[model samples]
Target: MRSAADRETAPAQGAAGWYEAADEPELVEHGAVTGLAVTGQGEPGGAAYNESAGALYAVMGALGAPMVPLEGRWWVEDARSPFEVPREEWRWHLFLRLPDGTATIDAARAEVCSGLPAAARVQHVSYTDGRCVQVLHLGPYSDEPASLARMESLMKAEGLVPHGLHHEVYLSDPREEDPAKMRTILRQPVR
Candidate 1:
């Protein structure tokens, strides 16, 4: 029989395979990687949903914990980032609804980040609303394939269908944690 370890490291959509962490995570303030925009929910110049959703998860990094399904608004305009890895994988990304004439996404992020701590990383934000279910996944990122399978099974059993994009909140930086023992949250938005 396959163990959890084998499932997580498996490739997922040509990227990191589905995985989960299994512990209560903590929270803290994080910075950078943000954007600004009017939340589609009707707030002018409000943050976009799904943009900078990683910020909340990043806080878990400060608390030595991980989070999942961070649904929020975010994005940065026209700014290539050094922190971002070049890949097609889903990011705990921020969404930003920009003005018709906004020059770049980074500019939007700067507008929103100004309200936050001076050191806050500017990122884009997007706005969205719907039923979303979340859970805390603990352990190595490699083991999440099984975890995701399990979550999918639960969703099926509950008669819930996936509605939006999946998300992961990285808690322990691989550089700091034992790869054999990592922490992250796997989330599937469903209805």
Candidate 2:
């Protein structure tokens, strides 16, 4: 028999694994997750992205859910490599995971519409990345290409092909943390 307190502190089913990745490239399978999300097209750290993020945080804070790390799914419209595409052209869905049994979307929407009009664009969304290749990326965001290249090499060696958007779980706040000490989980869904 487990105590209620113990159950309360336990991670939700599959939640613990979702945010973890090895320093070296490896395969992982993520279960379906539900959360609040807002989509936009802009370079990370640009005005549009920052505004959207602020809105998301405001709504989440209003809901009183425990803060979770921010996550992003990114892609580009151009056929060229995402790296080659202009930063301003990047499309992204920013996500904040809601705790299990959190308030309904209607309530969240109402909260948004009432005082946080900017968050009106936020929506309740769910997704399953399924099988993926992920690795822990350390240092500044600019150095992520090397980590991504390593993940790509592992994927190729394992006969995997990318099947979903490029994903990142931000484990450090760039505004407060040292760029050299930033940690991010880079994930790529694959088939």
Candidate 3:
């Protein structure tokens, strides 16, 4: 078994298969995971979202933990199709995965008090996505709809239905990488 420190230093090994996907949709089972997470509502790149992400990072830094790739769970409130919902109405939980046996939540909370006020909103959360359909999306985020549509098609063909919010694991930093080269793992829990 790998030590926690080894896992912390090598995210791909730490996460097992959580961060991988093929260009085509495939079924995957994800076990429960614990992480530092913060919630928000608004356009993805809007101010509120950015601030929450910053706070999450600050708390992680305060814990002296290695940063992991950012992940998000996304949804909308309106009954209308998610595509039809205004971007500003979208809700999300942004998170950074923590290694098993990491610092305690109380310790994380204490660190928050000394960092960004928004860090107070951060929580150690856990959830399981038993079965999912996922794909690796390449290129600009704006082009994700096409990838999503593909996932939907796969789910339908397999007689599966959505069971939870959409999930994304960002493998490339949007601010620094060429949009054409961006890589993201898109996943949706299904039954």
Candidate 4:
């Protein structure tokens, strides 16, 4: 994997550029990625979200891996838009990508124990995102809908339909960056 900065010059599939609504959505093919995952239902940036994130980093540290930015897959029941659901009812699979060759869950757990509130709930998993339509959302999370709409419009124009939950890659830490300058990659698996 390349640093986000390096990705800008790499390729569309690898570019880490923050896109605007006027920018065209890109279709990228991704291979399988391994990571530590935790599932929860509630508004993001809340206690449950924090604890799960802490546990993931704790496990990653145990495996001697560098701390990676957080990512998440989000969804709701009945095909309702995630925005249509109340924050308290949102469901998410939050995860951190593990470095290649990281130790197995059992092996890492034996060496370092996590005391985070959601530590026991963590799981190691791998999945292929396959084909996706993605755009860079460059502002506060609250403005994601605009980015998503543009992607959806592009997907529809291309005769593609969503194949899985919506995904987000946090490129800038909201804690340190101003909300107006935050960068996030918004992706939706598509066929």
Strongest candidate by lDDT: 2
- Pairs that collide in candidate 3 are none
In model 3, the runs with Cα more than 4 Å from the true position are 1-14
Sequence-dependent TM-score of model 1: 0.40
Question: TM-score, each model?
Answer: 0.40, 0.89, 0.88, 0.84
Error of 1 at 19 (Å): 17
Which lDDT tens digits does candidate 2 get at residues 63-123?
A: 8888889999999999999899999999999999987666577776677677767788988
Worst window of 10 by summed lDDT in candidate 4: 13-22
Q: Which has the better TM-score: candidate 1, or candidate 2?
A: 2
Which has the greatest TM-score?
2
For model 3, how does the per-residue alpha-carbon lDDT over 40-148 read when each residue is reduced to its tens digit?
Answer: 9998889999989898888888788888889999999889987899999999999999888875766766766674788889899996877888899999888899999
Clashes of each: 53, 0, 0, 0
User: What CA RMSD would candidate 3 show?
Assistant: 7.7
Task: Tell me the lDDT of candidate 2.
Answer: 0.84
In the order shown, the candidates' Cα RMSDs to the true structure are 14.6, 7.9, 7.7, 6.3
lDDT of 4: 0.74
Q: Tell me which of candidates 1 and 3 scores higher on lDDT.
A: 3
Model 4 CA lDDT for position 158:
67
lDDT of each: 0.39, 0.84, 0.83, 0.74
Ranking by TM-score: 2, 3, 4, 1
Q: By how many angstroms RMSD does model 4 differ from the true structure?
A: 6.3
